[model samples]
Target: MNHRQSGSMDSVTIAFELMRLELGAEVDNLNAYGASLFHESQYEEATKLGERGKALRGFLEKVQLLEAEWVNSFAGTAEVDYQDPAVEAATRQILSNSKSPKTALLVRYPCGEVVAEKKGADTLIEVIKRAGAERVAKLGILVNSENIVSRTPSKKYNEARVPPHFIKTHSSTAQKKRNIEQISDALGLGLTVEIIS
Candidate 1:
């Protein structure tokens, strides 16, 4: 399921939680929880429950592919759709495996962009650029306000920063040239500019 269609973050979070709860159940019989939930036309909730099983399975497949790439790398995880049971089950299997490390390099974002199907292949480069930006922010050496999982037409999000004085650095994408130009003009006080593609 396209998670973007999940309506809102609150609903998505709730649905994912329910999906988690359902996947771990060992019995085939419907629990009192299922009866009460499914009878009320809470199909979304029901889907959530079904998805755990699917995510676990997907997770396993991801781990196998990642394992093929590195000898000792921690098993990879599948991102839960929180909408499909088979997908969720696969995700669960991948994430819950004891072999997977706690700090596994889960691909949360590739170049400040998050989508099931990426348009470009420079995500790894994007990740490195993002890391550089974070380090710069830690040092207070640069402004660090680019949205990870960037958007098209680049609508500014209400992003909150921990170090309020820190500046956000943006990557160079021709698509964002106008916004970048505007932003650079706004930072007219001789702020340091770093260009990244």
Candidate 2:
């Protein structure tokens, strides 16, 4: 389907379409094979085939859950339509298990910047590496203030030298700051990193 048409469809429809396109055929094939095995009285083989079918169903369920979460999170506040090419691409990436840094998902801001949801320290880094400096500079990055909270202790400070809370909060903040700086340096286009709540 064209990008525009795909976006026009509601989230549930899109999820079903993706399942039909990507998994429906495999499911049908498995069921057919399993049925044949059952007819032949090959109980073990049929059971194995059923197991495979169950695994595929589990995968589909995961996709559906992720789609629902995505829809819930972005359906209302999104700047660009959910059916935009960028959002579609990101959805495909997520479904295909190609999402870099795992936790991040792509989101487009009102100013026409496509950024990944702030995840870990490597979220922006992965985006930069995947799209490259120029492309990423154009797309931009959004960093959440909450994600900047320090979670790891600094190497320079021991538990005895500072409170654990200080290490987690202050050190994590420093690490996030360094991550942003590194991302800026890698992009080399005076890349502006938008800090959001």
Candidate 3:
């Protein structure tokens, strides 16, 4: 199998490939019907395609997880080809889940040198304060909009209903900016905050 970067293939393409690999002779017929239903915007039939795609993805993830467990259990002596496309894809998926926040506070010195990079508002503020407010010139807070927007179900509830406030308070862009602004005010530093989608 040819190993390609995660960015090289979209979710749909990956799903198709997985189905072809696992289902063998049945993939062509199934894909043809799925494509027809999707193009016609047939929600009922299209749902089946979506479910199948999700199942394939889940299967791939599970296989990867099992492979990882086996390798770990046998110690570091297992001869595994990390270059295989399936292994690479699975590893990428696992790593993507564990990725650090792209959002960071860039601390710069008076001489226009970036002295430190810290993730999260609280830690960044603490570090800057410790570095001494007089030595720092400008502060840049980078926010990734995708991370700020909540995709998971909110646990907090208001009057028997899940309120939007739960998500907003935890990760909304507006809330993050407000927190950063407050930090800037406290530290008496010039703030350059950018929200990237």
Candidate 4:
């Protein structure tokens, strides 16, 4: 889980720790190759375990990187700039697959003003539009608000978040809150709202 945060000791090391506890020398040699690769600056190959006894910690990132390379390998090697549009284009392709619909993206920033904000609806709409995902609104949203009790008067409040999508674009908590009234205004609208604290 430390891998979820950016500046941890790197999950690869954590994996080695776990493997050392579980399998001892049967896995000690596995870490040796990764250590050489890490020090030699040959990240991709260095981490390669030949018929290994342990699973990797941050292996998904490696798989993603390798998959990205394999998709582009025929074009000959090019410097992989993560911020490049080619990466974005590939992402769009993944997102647009009709077989799986995903939620519209959500982002949050401290409103920064001293004023209170019931502005989630507007913020969510704008974010979707900016991502060229305005069409996602028709599918509806599921707002997952949490009202944390303040220990001190006017205590810090953490806003709720939209979860990861299992499917291209559908709904999110922000979208739900935005359209709740519209859903209610209609007769026989099959909608329910739940708030968690």
Q: Identify the leading candidate in terms of lDDT.
A: 2
lDDT per residue for candidate 2 within 48-120, as digits (tens), equals 9999988986775576566556666654344433335676567655544421221222333335666655543
Greater-TM-score candidate between 2 and 4: 2
Report the number of clashing residue pairs per model.
39, 2, 0, 8
Ranking by TM-score: 2, 3, 4, 1
Instruction: Give the lDDT of residue 123 in candidate 2.
Output: 44
User: What C-alpha lDDT values do all the predictions have?
Assistant: 0.33, 0.45, 0.40, 0.33
User: Per-residue lDDT of 53-139 in model 3, one digit per residue for the tens?
Assistant: 557556654754554454346423433323356855684464333322344334443456543334334434444355443332233
Superposed model 2: Cα runs more than 4 Å off: 1-20, 79-197
Runs with alpha carbons beyond 4 Å of true place in candidate 4: 1-59, 77-95, 112-197
Assess candidate 1 and give its lDDT.
0.33
TM-score of 3: 0.25
lDDT assessment of candidate 4: 0.33
Better of 1 and 3 by lDDT: 3
Error of 4 at 170 (Å): 14
- Misplaced by over 4 Å in model 3 are 1-33, 78-197
The residue-by-residue lDDT of candidate 4 on 1-197, one tens digit each, is 23233222222332333332233222333454445556778866754563342354245235434544543552223333234356445543432331311222223323422211244333443443333232333344322111111112211112323322211112223233334434333323333332111
lDDT of 1 at 107: 32
